[model samples]
Target: MRVHLFSLSFLAVCSTSVANLLGPVYPAPRDLSSKSSRVAAGWKALTGRLHSETSSGSSLLKNLTFSVGLFSIHDSAAESLQFHYTSSEIQNAPNGTRKVDGDSIYRVASLSKLFTVFAAMRELNSEQWERPLTEVIPAFAEYVKSRANADSVYSTPWDQITPSALAAQISGVARDVLPWDGGDLLLQYAIAILAGLNPVPAAVDPATYGLPPVDLNDALSLSPCLANVSEPCTGPLYAGGAANDAPVYLPWTSPAYSNNGFILLGLALANLTGKSLDEIYKQSIFDPLDMHSSYSAVPGASEFPRSVIAGDFTSGFGYDGGISKSSGGIYSTTNDLAKFGTAILNSTLLPPVTTRRWMKPVSHTADLQYSVGRPWEIYRYKHAESGVVTDLYTKLGDAGNYGSFLVLIPDFDAGFSIIGASALATRSNATSLLADLVTESILPALMEQAASEAKKNFVGKYTSDRLNTSLALDVSPSGNPGLSVTSWVSNGTDLMPLLGILLGNENSRLVPTIVSQGTGQVAFRAYTATQEKSGGLFQRNFDVNDWIVVGSGGYATKSLAEFVFEVDVQGKASRVELPACNVTLHR
Candidate 1:
């Protein structure tokens, strides 16, 4: 919602007025193909260049396995595209003999968090979001009770952490605890062997010989995973390991990444749903979206035909994240990732309001351009043409040789996904560059097309039968951010001046809220441009009101600036309802 009441602007701030537009000048709503072709060509060129350089054995990303694809909620008419490159070395591997394509699967490391949060959103209610982790998981509750009454560096206050906190990376727990590599012990063995000494010592008690001392957090002690070469920690060892984690920051003090936080959340979800995390994801997300190639656990031998083997084919290619799967272990293809992104963007499984609430930032970082959602890394993209900020909900995964990125642009009901694998440090850079290229080359065109489409359908003169009381709206032909109100009259009196305090020199625009108002009706919230005179000397909000008063006037709705437009079959508005003014104007 907009902090400032929606206002209007003139030609000085945006593109030319509607008089020069309204024809074949701008891209039609469904005519988004030319840009897509150019974007596809750009991606193909990048990968093709890398492949050529790799064949010559001179490229920095010589072994990089890369793929990217665009998706849309409206896919039937959408000109979606995919591009990929795989080395012949990989194609000849045992399990990777199959060529890479839309169905080819790679480990989507941290992107699994998106599925975890989606499961939580589907199974848990609003009240459960704030419920403490201690209250949900008995093992974790026991561990917290084992800690002394004081909060210190040795122990985290898990009782104060909630699913919301964990999902938002604000739980204040240690980032990770399992896979505590035992390199020192191996080094000692190496030194003993070099000196012609026996590296193998006589066996001691089985309970005390091979693992760390049996302490509160020695859950890994029951298993050999501390070698960091085994399957992920699960069961008591997983719970105990997480319980022993130290405090990194107090809850909500800062945004800190915590894999164990997600691990704990998986345990809590299992406790609440009476199902394993694997089952939960499969039933709630994967199966429902028809994501045939997606899996929370390792695929069986039959599924190996589609797996992308990056390295250490025996163990690493099909590594099971086990309890930590919710954090960084799942596998998917461009095809499946596209379906998943579409489901979230369209609210296919969840209600529109729930999706809206889920999409918002739970906490913001120090970086102005970045924010955090439940599992979303939101990047604020400002269209240079209209100066409107669009939040691109994204999730990026990086674990060992595997990397993935899922980006959703709600404004255009469009998004894209990228997944790649490489031992080189450049793997992350390659995926990031894919996102930047698409946003730079295609997003501006999409946004401009949206403005033009809205102008053709919604902008016009509307008046009541009472005469002299009318509304006129026009969008900038070049690129206004939203539908600008050129005129508004009520009961023979001009009310734009009355709302000037919130409107601010006529600079607000109506942007879609996606708030459903029955069929053929759409909702829009008002946003007025406000600036500060601090000259970058201070950190502050430029809004005109406090957060406390938000929605208190309309009880969860923007009362002052909400406009409901009754549209027809072709999406042209016939009338607009101004609830704040208790008036309806007809066209």
Candidate 2:
């Protein structure tokens, strides 16, 4: 890896012991005396590793400030830890040192979307979760139609988008439809200003950067709109001619990350609540959580202390953070974020049932390593040494110059939030390194906690002669509450790889973990379904709809397929019915 070491002139005196520099880990009142010592050791080890890794040239983790909060819903006990570090003087900010307590604010880009989504969800009811875009904010849908070519297919499809689908990044909008994901033109200007590079003349004009230049002195007082809109600013990438671009596909055909989706969702939220996005957030989430230091960057109205990007203290236009209204315009501190995350986990912010919906996998990547939730990313994080595969729900934010990550492991009753402010190009990768450390050093500390009973019934060998398939279910005791299954056809062939193309392959094995549709009887449910198809004359050419009978190319209009297992009088599995393949097998 090559380090694009842009010349930076920054100097600061930093000399402190690791223990002194990393402050105390806030523990639950009852366990404070005992838990503090245990948590300190892990914090020290994790920060020490991060500090050492920053010595590398290409590593984006030159400096980091973070907080970790551990809490259990069963017991009201909760704790938090804060750590700050400066790797080397080479990439450090001139005005600010790596020393940050819980209160130091950093610009957290996409992480802002989490707060926006949460606030928006709070204003909606169960039925509104699936409400169409046309109903939520028909005006925005009309705007989308006006920008597209008169005959474009996207104009009509815009009405079909749902708020929940947009939150999950499955709205079928082009990633740059509203182009809130940092415009290239704006980035060019930001890079020049931050890195002291040669100015790209193209970025200085309204036609170039998408929005008019921010008169530095006047930016704080002026409420500038992007184009003709009355909102503070929507980046030029999606403004004017940019909106004319065709969409990737019709709604929900597949998943594609869209900043525009979130932007539109934010507008819909305002329409629903009859309040500005920032106001809706403050009243519902920030104030209730006592996160005093958190604020959404909305033009001149709400500006919090922000770290400098490149060599300059930034505001207005795409300086510190990009000019995104609801997408990535938030500045918050470690302490506040820790509280926010803990509150969500404890159901203090949203009800437990709704919180679970936030983590549920709405859409998954092709490899299945990661799943997209409403505004969260869910995945199994495996610690190498402990070999503990735990489910990690995470939301990552990268504001060009700074990176932020909030991770939660509900099973372990703990989570960590890291905020890094730096000018390194690889700042986005900083969160991954810290997340890995949290999984390795911090999660194991909570090992004494008990596992869910759902695991016991799920681990067994299931086979069906008629269906010609066999399943070996094993207990990943350290993993989330679900059985891990290795599936095979009766011919001893792995059915996983072939299902990849047929089903968009989120994950291979079939694990009927959740119980569904039965009383006084043992039942199970699986997230996906699989069916067989062939390309030969007597067989079909594997129609896209063959495997999963749900979602875009499916036979049904649902997200997950249900599977039910029949158990004998002894509560032992006797046989199973696979819905996707329409087959019955004996255990």
Find the candidate with the highest TM-score and give its number: 1
What's model 2's overall lDDT? 0.54
lDDT (CA) for every model shown? 0.68, 0.54
Give the least accurate 10-residue stretch of model 2, judged by summed lDDT.
Answer: 16-25
lDDT of 2 by residue, 1-587 (tens): 11111111111112111110010011111221144434445656776876676566655565433443444433333445556654443135454434456676666777887887888777887677777766666454555666555555744355577778878888877665422334545544544555666555654434563576654234222222333333435432233323344567677777777776777777767767778777887898888989877777532323322432333455322343333457778877777877787788777867777877676777776643566787777665443332234566778776556667778776544677776655545455665666566666665554422222223344566776654577655543332223444564544667656555444453422333332223324334332322323444345323323223333333344322334567543234566555555566666
For every candidate structure, what is the RMSD over all alpha carbons to the true structure, in angstroms? 8.1, 13.5
Error of 1 at 147 (Å): 2.9
Question: lDDT winner among the candidates?
Answer: 1
Give lDDT tens digits, candidate 1, residues 528-561.
Answer: 4444233333343433122223222342353766
What is the Å distance of residue 400 in model 2 from its true position?
1.7
Q: Could you tell me the lDDT of residue 565 within candidate 1?
A: 87
* Off by more than 4 A, model 2: 1-41, 54-60, 63-78, 87-98, 138-156, 177-243, 298-310, 315-323, 383-389, 448-587
Model 1: per-residue Cα lDDT at residue 518: 55
Indicate the worst ten consecutive residues by lDDT in candidate 1: 1-10
Clashes of each: 3, 1
